[model samples]
Target: MDSEFENQCLEQEENEEYEETESSSVQEKNNDGETTKQLSPREVNTIFNSETEVCEYYRQYGLQNGSGIMIRNTRKIDGVNTYLTVACHRYGEPNQKVVDSLKPKPVVKTNCKARVCAKRMDEDNKWHVTQFDNKHDHDLSPSKAHRFRCNRKLTKHAKRSLNLYDEAGIPMNKSYNALVVEHGGHKNMPFSKKDCENYMREIRKLRLAKGDAVALQNYFNKAQSIDSHFYYSIDLDDENRIKNLFWADARCRATYKEFGDVVAFDTTYLTNKYDMPFAPFVGVNHHGQSILLGCGLVSNEDTITFVWLFRTWLTCMFGNPPNAIITDQDRAMQNAIEQVFPKARHRWCLWHIMKKIPEKLKGYKEYDSIKFQLQNVVYDSIDIDTFEIGWSSMISKFNLENNDWLNGLYEGRHRWIPCFVKDCFWAGMSTTQRSESMNAFFDGYVNAKTSLREFVEKYDNALKDKVEKEVNADTRSLSTTIPCVTPHAMEKQFQENYTNDKFKEFQKEIVNVKYCECMMLQSDEAIFNYQVEEIQYVGDSQTLRTVKYNVVFIKDMELEYEVKCECRLFEFRGIICRHIIKVLLFKQNVFTISSKYILKRWRKNVKRCHSRTKVTYSTWKDTEEKRMYEMVCDAFYRIVDLAAENLERCNHLVGTFKKLELEWDTNDKGCSTSIVTKPEYFVKILMVNVA
Candidate 1:
């Protein structure tokens, strides 16, 4: 029997009887052309009993048998395009020879009961079950399958690989003692070699990073040293701090020699760290340039502090007292100046004095009234008694109460020179304004966060820059010369035709000449309106013609000369422009200042304190020197109160408070002490002018 016949016999015997329906039955033809119908129950049973016959049946049927069918769940296969019927057979050639040539292929059968070879493929694509055949788990009972293999040579080796607790051996990780010794109490580590290797690599990388940081820090330190070295040069011992005062003193001595001292003093704050608060003191000479005399890192701001600072500065810079010390009328500063330099003529800045008038009278309702009264006090050319009467009248008109601040401020009335109240010779030199500008410049070098060393360095650099600028400017001014003789010399050289005598007399009678301190001639753009009657020789009419000349001075020394009769000298040569030459010669006998030259306005003579039984550096013995630096905690505590008192006084300030009221006329000078124009007008004018 063939394999198909045997399989049919087996099915018949198992089912007892089988009937083939039209849909279920299939027919096959033998190679000899014999046809066969569906098998009977007994025939199917017979086919299952004999394998060899069934193999022979496949040979006759021309179909491959006993070859495993490769069944793929079509839906499970990737990219399947159509659905499959589960019971249908797939198309392929079936031959017994082909089946016999096929070899058994190993298959992995999961969750099988047998332990030896796991599984294999037979004639059908079904699993031939086997069991786990691993000999590593030899300790397990033959009937049971619960045991699992611990795949390591020893307990210690297993612990090293898996980081697990082993009952049979010591742990492979570092011992507690070893860890403590190596890591200095940092004991965290995994047991496995792989984890340890990774941890060690990370530690090495961190160490390298730290080394790189250290190298960069060293390089930065070297670079900083190189940068600071450029501005630094060691000369005299610690003399950089004192250089400004030294240069200023030398310049002052050179310029003014025996001239009276006119020192204007001012002080302003410098912000820095608490340990080094620099207080800069600025002094100005007659020429209006500021001299930085001394600075202090004071812990407090008070009378004593000011005294110390002033004494140190004056002693170092002048070696004696200044002839005059002008400052704002601060009571503490006043007292300090009087006590220290008793001989110096102390004058108050007039701007500060007038700024106090509005400060004392707050009850004034109308700004125009305050302004008109104040203007009379400042601008009117009146005697001192008349000014006092006008001031009293203002007090009554304003209905303001007793104003002690003003009285106290202007107590020594003579000391307050009202330079700006009315235009004076020294119109611009009333206040320590230039000193205030210097103060602003000094503030740029120090801020609240600046360190002590940075403050000193900035101070030195600023002083150096200021000194260089002034020296260069002075050198430039010295190199320039004035053309004093150009006009006058020309008239002399022209002689007879120009009528040197007439020209000389004409210069003396008609022209005005002025000279600058720097010996420069002054000429301004001007226009003159005049008609010449006649120019006739009084002594000799035979030699001279009766010519009339009308001359007018125009912009930039240009002159227009019209002669009644044609005079080629005045017309073609434009000789009128050289009229100054005739004037210079006429004054050859009498000294005449240049037109551009004006005498420097007088500075109030400052007094120098005499070195009476002098106090020298050696005089300060050890005890006194120590006392000078003794910690004054009390002074620092009082500074807060002092500052608060000043603010409180300013709060009730009549002048400042009155200015704040909107009803106060903005244009009134006394009502508005702040020197600012109305913004609306300023902007409108600016726009119109610019357009």
Candidate 2:
């Protein structure tokens, strides 16, 4: 009657005469022929209705007495066990053969002579404990009794809770600690943390017995049935094992049509137990938030895998490749991008290249000066000629012509140097920071120990969070506005049109206009050249310096004007710079921004098709009922497609569905009445209508 089994009932007794004799005590003599003591009923003679009950009672008694119990022997008559003996776990000698094995283990058996013998009574068809011994040869550990394997168990409710925690990506240790705290302490808990972990491991093994590939396929199939826009592609090896996987939901595909011009791809994060690389294609949304366009898991980082992933993602997004792509300087990735996205302007991440300077040049005596000059040459160059001149000067000055790392970087300068790649629009990004940020966003949801099956579910949870954040930003943009800091109509125009986050970026340039001074240097019939001197703060010391940029203003036939600046800020970042604003607004008296400059991607009121596609994070168990539900949904989806072709058909289908729902509800409530019908009749009606 321990607390663990308070709700358990004993097996039914066949004879009523022996039921009242469930407990009895006996006296035993000591070795010296003196009466030792009177034993308790459990330690002397106890009657149980079943063999299992007898063994459980003896095990519980051993636990209370600070001893581990194990089944010693059993004698069966034909098929039924007629005699059984339960003994102390340390009641026997270790086998000499096993003790002398090559890989030896410490022996815990001490030949303790404590045991209980049970026999079946033919008259009552019940088991009775005929002999028992409560004495032990070794010291007992009452306080540590719960640590014995025979005493550890997890209840049904605890198992259910642990399964839920496992699905939510909670670590086993944390989940175990939560249970310990809930049960008051570790001693009060029924099982050890290791026991909980073993249970979880067994569950995972059962889930993966069919292989991770099948689990992934079933998950994708169910997801697509729930929402037809969910997309997934799996590449298999010759043995039909999963080699690579790519997935994108409806929201991701819809969002791509708007912000897929520039993408940042990276594969530095690993989230599954298989150690496969997690590659995420990330982009910047209208609110300057990092959005996931699509993602994949690859078994290898070679060119072939990259090609497969890229092509699969391209197909998912309706074959619309990004105009510009940014990634680290991986030669394999570079080759893959060239083969798959030939038209995409591939740029190396400048931050990634710049960060390697210390590691590559730290051995040099003048490493600080070399790094400083290299940064200046990479960042401060105004055009290609200036970059080449500064690069050559730095190499010659540092006597680094023979250095391999520097030479290799110089050969790839056009892919990373700002002055060389400024002509192409990169959405204000010079590195793969967006992809890295997206990876960091999932840190709280997944970890290195996550299984492939668990990772798929956690991925949905993380994406749902991202969607909710975007929706909240949209709501804020619609409900609130940021005030313009300048009197010029251009700042006000941006404030009215752009989202609040983008509007804040525009206001930054307007604020920096005070640091710029523009003066016309030359003039023609329809063209004017101006020199703009801008003050910039440099380094940690905030040293003040002035730099001059050339701005050209050209007037067209219809009085429309075009402005270009040597800085190329607008060309590279899609944002007009402070120097351009000074010349166009302060010098030329221009009032409003041009229509072409207002990117629809950043407009506040532009409706996105992806916003209507809901993202759900609910998980489904792999059961027969779930599979059947998916089949039913798939059939209904086909019917919906046919009905949606015309308004008349759609209305007719909706009316029929309503009538069916009403009849089902009515029938469900009339089950208690005399009038009852099988639900298959409704299915017959539905089948007739479909035919």
Candidate 3:
């Protein structure tokens, strides 16, 4: 038994010695074998898919091969996700080994003529097939020449190569000139008789002066005023006997005799030259349209000058004692208006009043609170007594003053309200905006050099054309389905802007309302005969603290298509007012904004102007496509340079981006080439025996 046990132990010892020897040999073999190369997943994918390494691929490489370079298993080291992968290349045989391990992929060829196709020859050299593109047309046509011979022609790359030259300054190797050149000339069109006279005056100046360049420059400067960009005119006084001569006649009348006596006046500033200003005045008419009474050139916007100009215009045009007047919140202008038309109502413009509330209530912070209340005052939906209470509270909170320029009406409560005027139909027409449109239309005609005579001529022509269109439109409306609101209904809507007592006063005086298209009705003899108060009483009390206006509702004129006013609010918005709404309420089809009121006169003769010109090669032909491609490619390189500069500005941004994979791809054959789409594939042909 003792002998058998000893033999078993010896056998076990022998087996243990053999196993250790085998294990050591295996370890030695592993150490001797090629160092196991580690590669990034991105590098593996690149070699697996294709041979070419793009910007996205190069971005993946680590500095050296067989090193412990960290490979990103996922985009996020923490929380955020990245749309692209980033990796780095490892160098030497280990990287080569990684490349070798990847499955073989066939190299894809770019069939673009813009780039040469080359293949890897061993490691460093590249092999190319010269003139490979010329082997076949690849199309059904015998050649590219036959295919591009239609209306828009093109040359094949082979043909282009034959004509090429090497020039650095000329951009492309082969220069392509435009097929035709446009004329470098201009012509003057027919002008109105007054405009012709102006032109003749300029020509006379040019002919009379034979001087040095400086003198000639001065003469040309004066002569250039003949070019009126916007106005067209014909002279009745001319030898040619042109019937219509246009002149700047900014004059209108406001004959309001009803509801005691009242006249509202306002003025606004306009920019003619980029920085130069012009002031134009407006006189509110009972019709709700502001009458463009006059315009004057002022060096500065101040009260005394405007007041003098306005009083002179009123005396010359309408001649009278306006029992009450309304002006903008300008203290100087208001003071002057009061001095001139002492008998007039002398109220501040409601439009200007509303605009000033925001300035007065500076600490309120909430703009909507002020805007909503003022809108109610203008529209006349909210009760004036209630408005007073609300306004007083806001004024008290803000510590605003009644006499402050921004709160003009707070000192003149009842007089300035729309309901206080007999001409309630014209109540909402406050802003100088409506009259300003005419000036805007004519601003294109005048300039710094414009004389009063030239301005007058341009202004008259525009107004005459406008008035004539309005007159002609009446006939068309009668035939159309558009309706005109009865005058009674118009008065009713105008009443909405006023208080209950004011509406009662308007009803008491206005026996009947008339709806006449185009022509002003002479039937309302009472409107002219209504008593006017010559003596004016200046109220010591302040105006209402807070006034509210609203946009009552909008109505369409089905027949005439001319918007009518009910509250007379249209004049403020430059559309039909609420007075027109009264017209709509009584008769649904009273007025509509049809072709008559909205038709534009200037757009009529466009086709005639177009037909007079002839078509030619200069109008149609352009440069060759290859030249365009070269220009576009150069522009792209410039864009890339700019992008690089922009990136340099934000190094911190670059650091942020470095945390994620942002592989910029710019390896496509068309990266800098203008030929974007691929050409048709040409099947390789091997000569075969014919059947």
Best by lDDT: 2
- Per-residue alpha-carbon lDDT of model 3 for 163-202, expressed as tens digits? 2321111212122321111112111111122332344346
Q: For candidate 3, what is the TM-score?
A: 0.34
- TM-scores of the models, in the order given: 0.34, 0.79, 0.34
Q: Per-residue alpha-carbon lDDT of model 1 for 1-691, expressed as tens digits?
A: 6999999977765442222222224575744588866431122112222232332332222111111111222332255322221110122323334333468443222221211111213354332222212112111121111111111012332223322111111232543334434434432222334444454345334433444234323332433343321111111215322111111222223323323254556543454654434555455432345655445555444687667666765554545666666676677778888888898767776656665556655455685677666666654413466667776787687764465754564456667634212212221343636545766666545567554333444555566556555455444334532222335444233322222222333243333222201111333335432223333333344443332323332333433222111122222112322223223333222133332322122111222221111222111112332333222223323433444457554343433335444434564535653333333333333233322
Per-residue lDDT for 473-576 in model 2, tens only? Answer: 99999999898777788998998888898888878988998999989999998999999999999999999999889999998999888999999988887888
Candidate 1 stretches greater than 4 Å from native: 1-260, 269-279, 285-287, 353-363, 379-383, 419-428, 481-691
Residue 304 miss distance in model 2 (angstroms) = 1.7
lDDT of every model, 2 decimals: 0.38, 0.81, 0.35
Model 2: residues with Cα > 4 Å off, grouped in runs: 1-46, 72-84, 89-108, 119-125, 621-691
Give the candidate number with the greatest TM-score.
2
lDDT of 2 at 100: 56
Q: How does residue 104 of candidate 3 score in lDDT? A: 52
- The predictions' CA RMSDs to the true structure, in order, are 39.6, 12.9, 26.9
